[model samples]
Target chain A: MGKNLREPLLKLLIEQKEGYISGEEISQRLICSRTAIWKHINELRSEGYQIEAKPKAGYRLVYRPDRVAPEELIPHLSTTSIGRAVRYQRSVPSTQSLAHEWAKEGAQEGSLYLTEEQTAGRGRMGRIWHSPTHSGIWMSLILRPPIPLNQSPQLTLLTSVAITRALRKQTNLPIQIKWPNDLLIHGKKVCGILTELRGEQDQVHYVVQGIGINVNATESVWPEELRPIATSLAIEGGRTFSRPELIGAICGELETLYDGYLSYGFTPIRILWEEYAGMLGQEVTARTGQGSVKGIAKGLAETGALLLETHTGVQTIFSSDIEW
Target chain B: MGKNLREPLLKLLIEQKEGYISGEEISQRLICSRTAIWKHINELRSEGYQIEAKPKAGYRLVYRPDRVAPEELIPHLSTTSIGRAVRYQRSVPSTQSLAHEWAKEGAQEGSLYLTEEQTAGRGRMGRIWHSPTHSGIWMSLILRPPIPLNQSPQLTLLTSVAITRALRKQTNLPIQIKWPNDLLIHGKKVCGILTELRGEQDQVHYVVQGIGINVNATESVWPEELRPIATSLAIEGGRTFSRPELIGAICGELETLYDGYLSYGFTPIRILWEEYAGMLGQEVTARTGQGSVKGIAKGLAETGALLLETHTGVQTIFSSDIEW
Candidate 1:
């Protein structure tokens, strides 16, 4: 009734910290009857919310399922624009495609599309991105920056820096950003960012930044081939983290950095990115479509290209797969 | 019958040169009954195809409607990849959006979308492109080129060169390319090209090139504001031209130029573009988002950017509206 009053009911239950919220108290807070409150509580219980209900003690939330439901995440998300307008789906092929369609249909600049799992998710150059159900944070954010076409790569770099800072602040694991779009924990990748641009010849219409993080996933989430190089926060930190909380923290950090990027230019983001970068001065090979370039990693160019000190000279890589 | 035999039926009628094909003979050629052939002829007559039937004689094709139907264009088109797979709409808002959606849905690399008219067509920088009904060529072509992101502007320049060459060869009027996106007939804009790129950070997935040419539109087709600036081939050349023929010529030229661009690079197309450029040595002011740059219009950069010789120095303009 009334479009399922479970979200507000769940919000009220989460707000009550110390004790139980009586059925009558919930009815008064939500402006509903006692029978309606009882029904909602039963539905929540069926959905894996361990709510204890007693005759005198009323109702209390004991535990919540490990799900990134909007009802659970909305209460924790604190942002002015980044996560304010969100489209959450239970499962999808890829949030990137959905975000692109929505962006073309006039989705707001900071709209976010969150999915519990991606069946046919993609990485850079059409690589397969493993996104199992209810195990990680798989989402795409739509950004409409009034910048030139050549500078769009900076948005991807800015996003990596934001996510790396968010993960660094949330967990004790040492998160390092491998140029240009990976987050590693002790040399194993914990997250990846793929930023796609749709625009005219010289101006960007919108950008879809797809960020996938193995937050609460364990080692079992990775396939056999990826076991040696893939990792998650739970595997590295030896403890599970809240997916909703991590999503909120990432949205917050991204909003701050994105605002700074728009106002003061990319200098601030570039500096933070250099600090988070872990492969500077290391011998590496960048495999591109043309060939391979082996060199010592120097830094990032002004336009966010990877700068390499090759034997010939300082080379700038626009697209490549890094191997150390 | 059999999905409207008008296309093949029209082809049969056109192949017979100076005389009429007997009704009995037509039925044998098309493997249809004589009554079915008569009914199809009536249907074609109702759709503005003038067929004369004489006593003891057969039907003779007298006149054809001035519509760019696929049935009318397919036989004349001679391209290997371009215009091979086409989607035609009677009316649509914009072919650009439709081509973009189709491209995302795995439409082939050389897919072309054509519309009889665009109710809400768009030009560069989100400007309005007036596309009246059945009077111009409004189409979009999808191309998946394996080129880097910075080189995308060359596609737009290459398209301009192709369209200018086609127009010059078809009509004897002096057709010129106004830098970046517009085609001019004696200094009045006649055609416009808007090339939109959709891709990841460093590589291109596909490019949708929207081309709109005012082929047979009369002077009254333009609004009062655009009357002084806009011109059509019919207005400039003092006679109407076939829209389908122009569309076929454009696709043929574009396919040849695009193939050369992929194999031999942008030098050939750039040379042709410079020859058709009307404002090369003229004094012009480029109004950008930041400010205006007044200079002598020198030429194009290797990357297809407009080069301007200002009093300060040579400035390369990526996006701007030009004023003389």
Candidate 2:
């Protein structure tokens, strides 16, 4: 049997979902032998697809895989450009680092680097992100936006909104965005977004957005120190979610928002971000390198900077760590 | 003698400039044979240094080299760090490209990439920089500054001041800086600077400052189309100048000015830049991608943007091409 028979076999099983289609029917439709169909069904089974085979009843599609492999995600993805080229890795040091290298080597915009596990995952301010094996979405998307350098921070905010919307749709949970790009549920960190840009003053060459989401990690999976501050979807919802479905949702939402941002500027994304923002209208302390500013988080500026109404005046924070 | 005897031989020639020391004296002082001393002197002569050698009167340093080789330029560089690590090349695609690659490979700050000729040199906005063979200074300096991304354009302005001051000392000509970083002598371009940066919103990885100076190009060396707008030092000053000396002066000035800008602030550089600015207080048309703005060039703002007083209001030009 040819290696390409599995896709056709899977498609036949999906098309004839009512009853079991005989092997002779699949062979006649796909122009292959019954041995090829049997081999393909076994390969599909190894990829985590549940298929029931009988002497006369043939194969039936029962369930799909929870993994984020291309065969599983591409069929569900409805985006135009984003996630068109997805590189799946079982393990990597850092998706952001690999995406940066691929971007340097002239990788097209919307190329994605996704890993099942990250050995050296990173967070903002050189912090370490806890990404266990196959328990989270550790991925980076490469984007070449035709925008000025100053407008880049808006994309980070836009990504946060995309992620929040995707999670809300999937889990029906109240997912809120922390200022700048941290996804939180009940004031506990569930996801983190890191945006890195390379460019000149007037133009941006590329922006690599790395997103890490704790989707299926259990309470015991997290360290004792981080258990109070971090929570996962499985831990909070008491049910494991399909990672491939969530990734597809996120990519589709990101492509739509990215296209909107490129066409209409950052106004729409700013509104969406404020809708999901957790700190708006609340007093928070932003700790910067110089000092801390105690103020009420009003909204975002036109350039996506945090607008804080401090005691002195309305101060715009380009970058900082916020705490309530 | 050994291959490392050039510095000692050159030192002996410089020390006894009043009269030529005997070959026996040079050979005994440097712990090398007379034949080895002769070979080292020939090598120095081939490198463009004028050395007077005789059987009775051994060798005297007459003049330094016009080339910007490491052997010649390193000795004259007085900067603490800027030119401490120099990479000299006879030909390259672009110094900026090479410097960027080196910076990605963890090159330290103040590392320099210099070439006598560039086959594929580039300018701002994807323009082609004219870099002929052996008649100009084609160099790029790698810098790792601890500053926000918006403050990077200030470094371009600071580099312009350094190059202008260095040329002022070398030629004593009426040199003026066009808006941004073009150096003009008598309304013709003698130098052009292109600054490319790699960074994020709040941190810079590195900045490659590529400077190309028309130091010794004669009138015929320039293309017929560029003859009216471009002028070289050899044509303007009626004599060839040493490129190594000019490079040394520029590096020293840059190191001092860079340190001052980092420690004190951009106020000092802004003041110096205003003094040498050609379009300040003059009516000019700034052409950008969107449109053109005709106004009187007022001064630079604190962020190094060109501030122009137009009929509507004072407009800050982040990037534009200026013409009178």
How large is the interface RMSD of each prediction?
A: 1.4, 1.9
lDDT of 1 at A30: 85
The TM-score of candidate 2 is: 0.79
lDDT of each: 0.88, 0.86
- Candidate 2, B106-158: lDDT as tens digits: 88889999887899998876688888877889999999988777678899899
Best by DockQ: 1
Q: Give the Å shift of residue A15 in candidate 2.
A: 24
Candidate 1 residues A1-324, lDDT tens each?
A: 564688899998888875798888888878998888888888777544789988887898988667777787888788999988889987799999899889988999889899888999999888999998777899999999998787888998999998988888999779999987999988999999999989986589999999999877767777999999999998999998999999999999999999999999899999899898889889999998779999999988877899999999999898888998
| lDDT for position B216 in model 1 | 79
Residues A1-324 of candidate 2: C-alpha lDDT, one tens digit per residue: 497777777787888866789988899988999888888888676544688887777778887657777887888799888999889886789999899999989989899999877889988756798888778899999999977677788888999999999999999888999987799999999999988877766678899989999998877767899999999988888898989889999999999999999888889999999999989999999987658999999999988889999989999888788999
The interface root mean square deviation of candidate 1 comes to: 1.4
